[model samples]
Target: MKKLSFSLLAMLGFFAIVFVSCKDDDNGDPAPLTPTIASITPSSGPVGTSVTIAGTNFGDSPSVSFGTTSATVASGSTATSITTTVPAGLSAGDVNVTVTAGGETSAASTFEVTEGTAPDVTTVVDTVVALEDLSSLETAVVAAGLDDDLAGDGPFTIFAPNNEAFDSLIANLDVADLTAVVAALGGANALAGVLQAHVVADSLPADLIAAQDYPTLNAASTITITVEGDNVFANGAQVIGEQIIADNGVIHVIDSVINVEAPAVDPGEPNVVRVVASPDGLGAAETNWTADNTYILDGFIFVNDGQTLNIEAGTIIKGRPGQAARASALIVAAGGTINATGTAADPIIFTGEADDLNGSVPDDANALWGGVIILGNAPTNNNDVGGVKSVEGVPTEEGRGQYGGTDATENSGTFTYVSIRHGGSLIGANNEINGLTLGGVGSGTTINNVEIWSNLDDGIELFGGTVNVSNLVVSYSGDDGIDIDEGYTGNIQKAVVWHTGSTIISTDPRGMELDGGDGPNETAMPFTTPNLANITLFYDDVDGSNLTDAFVMRDNYGGSLYNSIAFNHDAPIDLERLTTLGESSYDRYTAGDIVISGNILFNINGVTDAANFADLFEISNEGDAALETEVETALAAANMVVDPGFGTGATKFTPTADAVTDLDSDDDGTDDELPEGVQNLGYKGAVDPAATEPYFANWTKTWAVISQ
Candidate 1:
């Protein structure tokens, strides 16, 4: 019994020893020793400098920190030695070095940060490759085969998005990874354009940046930079992190990806609420046209004398198709008034019934309906019986169409921020309606920020009116952008006349057709002495289909042009010496009554050579050497035949900084200085280069959807 008890005790002791050994194996060695830093090689250095941390018990994947900022662990590190580069955003000062491993952190060590010289960077491509967060950008650069171009010696500014940006973009697109995002972005060619949109061809440092649109490598795109307080945004994406400096360029980290598609603009729905506008007599009570409904004109609608038509902003007025006296139009008779004031956010639109405002109609669609006509009791050179004349485009017997009286300051109404599209119809032979016809309109009538596009006839025709206009944009007009006749003596400032190289009507298209008066009374009084300043006339005849001149000054036109620009036209100026009574504009030019100076003309007839200046004026009397010399001398003194440095594609009409500076500093005043009461806030064109928001932008259909 004693032997058995001794054996049981031995067995129990053996089992206990086995259990202890198994437990020790499961615990697995001792917890790793706390990491330690013996010394740091070259303890002081700048950011991005290679740093070696020599210490004890540093595990394979130990993390490192300089003060509170984290440093990226470089490759080829050992258990006892760790390599890292000094992190960015660190100030020049002393920072504590720390090593953390196996859930243990080492005591802090001192590291002195000193400002160092900029790194000797290679190409932007190389710089991108060196950044871990920019791996996605590097991948795209390689995939797009733009690596070679970017690697070359270049002054490139790259707006790079980090991996997290790409991740966010991928998630937004409902895609899995970068590859999927690329595929979803319309494959390689489209992705290439999108990627190029982030890069500018020129080097732009942070200090040189401003609140403006920066042209990108993608010709059609511009990175619009908006600075709010201390934050800078590119295409609504916040620029994050420090700007990475490179040899040939800079790299700005953006938080979000730029959209690959064109900026989506909601043009509002078409045909909301339908209502028929009365053809005549709006009564003494004010007729309010609201935006929540669409007003339709079945025939020539008339706002009779002493009546008022108030159109709300964003109101849509559609005219039905007809001809002759039955044409659909809105005629504000003499002594009538229309208060059509619209904001930039909500412009009053006038179109034909067929127009859906969805860009479905062809750009050249015109003559679909008659246009808006305002007749006032203001003086005209062609006044007949009782010092009045029947307005054209209206029936001769229509007593309400008679315009002209002794009053030069008659108040017709206010028309601001209004867009007239798809109008101008042939109501009579050689008498097509204009987009906005001001027949004997007085100086008291306020017309500003008006856009007339796709009109069959002139965009805005002023017939013996003293009504001054500002901020006018006339695009794709079938006839002249602005046609002045019957001795119009008013001021037109800051106007943009763009002809897209296509003619919707057979009539000659010109930037401005200035005529003193109609035939038989061509040289009648007032002399069409309109003062125009800061006008930009552009003809985009990429297909070489247009051959019209920019300005056709004829019929004894005696006007002054100052601080204007004309580009891509066959000829800048044309003077008619019609060998007929009172039809010689050259006579007016020689008399110093017609001044065309301080203007910029570029690429006339597709050539930048100043020799083209010889062809600048197309006059009927080519043999008149004295007249030619006088005109040449006047133009050569103040005009430039060099490139105006316009932006490309969507911003094709926008001027560059140098162009604006050159024009703004122009002191050419005396002869062609703007008359008093006209603001000479000159930038030499319709759109001000230094303006944060363009006058012709956002609201105009051409700027919002058509041009894009």
Candidate 2:
């Protein structure tokens, strides 16, 4: 280095400074660093345990893998660290976890998987939050206000859907994200119902998952599990991977979200955002009323001939309150079909518009809506032109309302697990609609597990036809529990009729108002002969007015009653003798067409003289004292007058073991032969005492306060 002149030296120093500044500025964006893992939190944990990886350079959209299994990278991940959960299907041993980000792979870090008989104490919410695939589900749970419930000590079984499933749902809905999906479904309340359909209120493991229907936490909803070989599907959604067990519950990951038939719609809310009105016409096309919305029956909504009305389970149908022509109802005409089949967990509900379905309804809630009317092509003795008459509640102008034909085995579709509540609106003068009106319904139609509650008129009335019914619960009816007319010839089994014994009811609230036929056709062919068995009729006193009758057989009625019960009624049995008709109900009883035996009548009319079966009717035994003595003799032989030892309140018909044994002893095959459709249960009164779960336990409402 030679010492130069001052000017030259200053220029050289300036060039050196310029070169140094250039080098400093040219250190462009640090060499694209490769992610490196320093340490892993809690060196050991079981599958589904949250493990944090202290690392460097974990860019966006990083993927983590534990050994051969892929781990789910949880939220709150950064360049300096990565949080992940131990994935399922991995062997219990030490494994290496690695992260790949920015097209750069990270070195492996040691992690021990300690799978034990029991997993760590984590709630369902915690487990859902820990898994990345369940991110959408977690958001939904929170939005639906189910997070807290899942976190509580529920021991629930959650069928969780993956992210791809949610994405697919969003794509199918043509929406953007979960929020958009929620909005598309109606609102948070609707979304909640859909989400709740995936949650069961029990800890059901995969091994225990069989092909059956399971009730969900959603009110009036259920998920059907179908086992196809080794794979199990819930509502057509396949259950993937092993079940993740949590402290509070078990989680079975599904490939898709379980599709709810209908999400709950708040029809009672003012200015409801969604209200599906009836179609514009007398004849409705084949349409579906999904559970995802609330339907409004502005007037008599008819499923005309050849049309179909498919109602999904858990659907809420609200009828607009009106009378006469404006009365709202669902009428299934002849040749029309109504597929309203609901499971025990999810019943099709028909109520007024004011009902919120929050159990806020009182026991006396009646006449808030109309009822269901099903008609079919069957024989009738109405004596009208062509033997066809307009269904009582519907207007005669609507030709579709006319029922009855030559076909004796016609079908009107299935109606099961249905509830008709607060119905029976006045359709005409002295003609309020029955909760369930079967007009000439044939034997091919199925009607079972039906509940009629708080009706202004008869709970169920069958006018002609031969449609059999079972597992019926009728409560708080203002009129009769069951009414038969126009030569109805069917069978009714396992029926419970409860009169709240309230004084605010309509006159003549009988347990059974049976008739052979309508008007002058009282002696018509195929008389109203119902083979009824295992029936429990409870009529309570109203303000010390013991006026309710249990059985009022008139108009030459002919039926069979076996293994039945009639309790707390002023008049237990009354047979009318129509002198105009050659054959009366009393005459029919003598001729063996009307059989009433193997029955239990407890505390009849406070055990007064009026309680006597022959005296209650106050009818001439056809000038034959022997005929009256015959009924008394039959009552003394097989009938019982002792207390039935029924469980009080809601389980008023659930008989005790002693009562069951006593009833069974009286059930001799001689005269108590059950019909083809009815079950020949040894013990009687609508309930099998040995059944662990009663038929009326889970589905019925206001059972305890029936007469309050």
Give lDDT tens digits, candidate 2, residues 1-708: 355687799999999999999999798565666899999998998778998888788987788988656778888898888888888654455778888887788888889877722212211211122222235555656654555555433323322122211211222132334444445545545333234323333333333222112222334444455544433444454433333211111122322223332333334655332322344434447788878777777677878787888889988888765445446788887888999988888888888765666644445666666899999999888774667988887766678788887788999999999988888766544667899999999999999999998887899999999898999999888888998888888899999988866622566778888888777677777677888988998776756655467887888888888888887887646777656567888878878888776677776655533245455333444445665566767655656666777886555678774655454444454433455566668786987878865686666664435322
Candidate 1 global CA lDDT score: 0.69
- Point out where model 1 deviates above 4 Å: 1-280, 383-387, 578-583, 621-623, 664-672
Q: Where in model 2 is the C-alpha error above 4 Å? A: 1-284, 608-626, 657-659, 663-672, 703-708
Looking at model 1, the pairs that clash are none
Local distance difference test values of all predictions, in order: 0.69, 0.68
lDDT of 1 by residue, 124-226 (tens): 2111222222355556566545565555333333221222112112221333344444455455443332343233323322322321112222334444554
What value does the lDDT take at residue 65 in candidate 2?
88
Weakest ten-residue segment in model 1 by summed lDDT? 245-254
Query: TM-scores across all candidates?
Result: 0.59, 0.59
